[model samples]
Structure formats: C-alpha cells, structure tokens
Target: MEVDATALAGLQSEVSQLADLFKRRLFEDRSKNALIESVQDQVRAVNDLLRYREFEGLFKEALLAIDRLQSESSTPELVDSVVDELLEVFRRRDLVAVDDSGIFDPRVHEAIGTVPASADLRPNTIAAVHRTGYVLGDRLLRPAQVTVVVSVDD
Candidate 1:
C-alpha cells in the first residue's frame, strides 16, 4: 500500500494543534497557581495584622479608613477592614515602626525639618517620626512621616 504525502501532512497538522492545546492548558495551570499563591500571601499578612498581640494598642487609623470606605463601597477592602477592625492606636503614642531600621524615608516621611545629632547618627536618620505609617503586606500603605536627624560636624 502506497501512502500519500497529503495524509501525512494532515496528521502533522492535527498533531501541531494538539500540542498547542496542551501547551495552553499548562500555561493556564501555572498562572492560576501563581495567582492563588499571591492571594494566600495577602490573606496571611492580613491575618497576622488582625491577630497581633497588641490588638487594642494598634491604632485608630485603620478604623478611620474603614469608617470612610465602609459606606462608600462596602466591598470589604482589606485596608479599609483593617481600619475598622483595629481602632485603638489612635489617641496615644503607639506608632508602629514603618521600617525596621530607623532610617529616614522621604517617600513616607515628610522632611518638615532637620536636627543635629551624634557622630553615629548620619543625616536623614529618623530622629522622630511625627506620624505613624502603615503597611499592607510588602507594600507601604503609608510612609512614616518623620523628622530626620543630621550629625553636626566640628
């Protein structure tokens, strides 16, 4: 039996289509997994914030955000909910460290003024954080508005 090239070409086309289908499915699966992992991370971060040891000492910023957004959209935005859920850190001096290091950050901190300090303290060191900052996971929801310090050279 003599096989024609047309039949073989048709078979090759079908195989190519099948391969593409499988490739697309694989890509979709991987993308979906990545999305799920991101959502999980956000959930975990939010959970940690919610169950913080000093829950009452956190702040009223979160609560204020919630109050403003709750009626506007009522969609349960994470930051807004946190605002509502945690509402005690407002009236006192319980500012959470925006950055682990007391480094100066112009982004979150407004350079209202600068001051002189010790030799070890370089300029832009956060001598005082006038305003507390908030974090949403790895993202900085709000930068810590602070006063930077500079070392007075002799």
Candidate 2:
C-alpha cells in the first residue's frame, strides 16, 4: 500500500526534530565534561599551593633554629644534635642542601657581597656562604647567600 503524502511529511518532521534534540543533548554533555575538568584542575592547583605554604613554614623554622645555634656558643654535641635535626627535617621534605665548594654558580647561589681575591682563590669563586641554599628534586627552592671573590684591581 502506498503511504499518504501528508503522513510521510509528518514522519519526516518528527525525525528532524528528534535529530536536533539529540545534537543539542550531545553538545550539552560535552560542555559539562569540560567544565568538570576545569574545576578539577583548579582544585589540584589550590592543593599544591597549600602544600607549598606548609613546607615554607617548616623551612623557615628550621633555618631560624640553625641560625640560633650558630650565633650562640654551644657545645659541639649540642651543635651536632641541632644540625642533625635540621637535616632530618630537610630530608623528609625532599629538600637537599646546596653544596658549598667555593664554586660560585649564579643559578643556585646569590652573591650578597664580594671579597678581595687571593692568590689561591680565583675571582668569581665563592669566598663564604652567609646562608645555605636548598633544592627540591632538581628545582631550586632557595638560592644560597654567599660572598664571592673579586679581583683587587676591579
């Protein structure tokens, strides 16, 4: 039996409406998924910032303790114990001390002052370390404060 023209047109209209509805729904789903991912990324960033703040506080405390120990005339045993405790805290936080080998590196060391270069010590070499620097997993957390040797003529 032949289908009625009016009936066929009505069926086509319904199919078109259904297809449009499906497309709209798919678009909405994708937008919702993108919004969810953005929120997740923001949350992760906030958590990372909080962790960094906590680590900063702990590091400052350890530095202060070490400074006090150095300023005061303490027994060798007490100084050793204090140093060990500071090191333990750093180790737990994955912080490594920057080596002070009289070698000056601008990347990890901050030259606070300059000293006269001697015959044995070359210019630009680290003469003294005023404050120790630290690194976290190949990333510098803080630059070491140091005094560098400068040529007497310069």
Candidate 3:
C-alpha cells in the first residue's frame, strides 16, 4: 500500500511535539515536588525550634522554683509536690524518662565520672545517674548524666 509522504511527515511532527510536551510536563512536576519538599522541611524546622523554646522556658521555671525551695529550706513534702508537678508537665509533653539500666549506652547516657567496680556491679555498667535524661517521641532531648563502673585494676 502506498502512503502519502506529506501525511506521514505531518504525523511524525505531531508525535515529536507530543513527546516534547510530555517531557516538559514531567520536568515541571518534578520541580514542583522539590519546591514543596523544601517548604515542608523549613516548616518542620520552625516547629522544632518553637517546641524547644517552649520546653526551655518550662525547664527554667521549674529549676528556679526548685532552687528557691532549697534555699528557703522548704519542707520535703513541698519539694516533692513541686517535683511531681514538673514530672507531670514532662509527661504531658511526651517527654519520657530514660531508664537507668545497669547497661551503659553512650548514645543516651553521658558519663561524668567513673567508680570502682564492685562484686555486685559489673564493670562498665551505670553506677549512678546524677541527672535524669528525657526523650520526646524517639528524639533524645537530653542524655542522662551518669557515673560508670570501672575496674579497680585500672
């Protein structure tokens, strides 16, 4: 069968133009997606900063109150009440207390000192926790300040 040369050329031209249009549309879609991702990242960063600031203010207030109570030689019951209130605030914010397991984990615990290992305690284990650590939704807010056990030989 014989086809018209002019008609064939026209069809080819239309196909090429369609291909170019598709390419352009794909590029535009990708560009738009990238821009949206960048904007979302910025918003997430801002939200994190705001959350941190809020937690910082609360912690500062709690610390000041505890300090004042100590200076005033407040009753143990009063101090306990303040501590309970602070813990409640932490719980409400989804800040969980890090467990003080005998195992020492560098990722979640900060060793401030070392103590001689005892028969009851294994070496390299957490001997004491000076300050409690907290985590919020798998994000570590603070590492637990701790003392680790060391061998007497060392």
**Local distance difference test, per candidate?**
0.69, 0.90, 0.89
Which parts of model 2 are misplaced by more than 4 Å?
Answer: 1-76
Residue pairs clashing, model 1: 59-89, 62-83, 63-83, 108-143
Q: Estimate, for each residue in 1-154, the C-alpha lDDT of model 2 and write its tens digit.
A: 9999999999999999999999999999999999999999999999999999988978787988788787888998878878888887877878899987867999999999998988887998988999999999889999999999988874
lDDT of 1 at 132: 73
Q: Please name the candidate that would achieve the greatest lDDT relative to the true structure.
A: 2
Q: Rank the candidates by TM-score, best first.
A: 2, 3, 1
TM-score of each: 0.35, 0.59, 0.53
lDDT of 1 at 79: 58
Residue 1 error for model 2, in Å? 30
How displaced is residue 125 in candidate 3, in Å?
A: 1.2
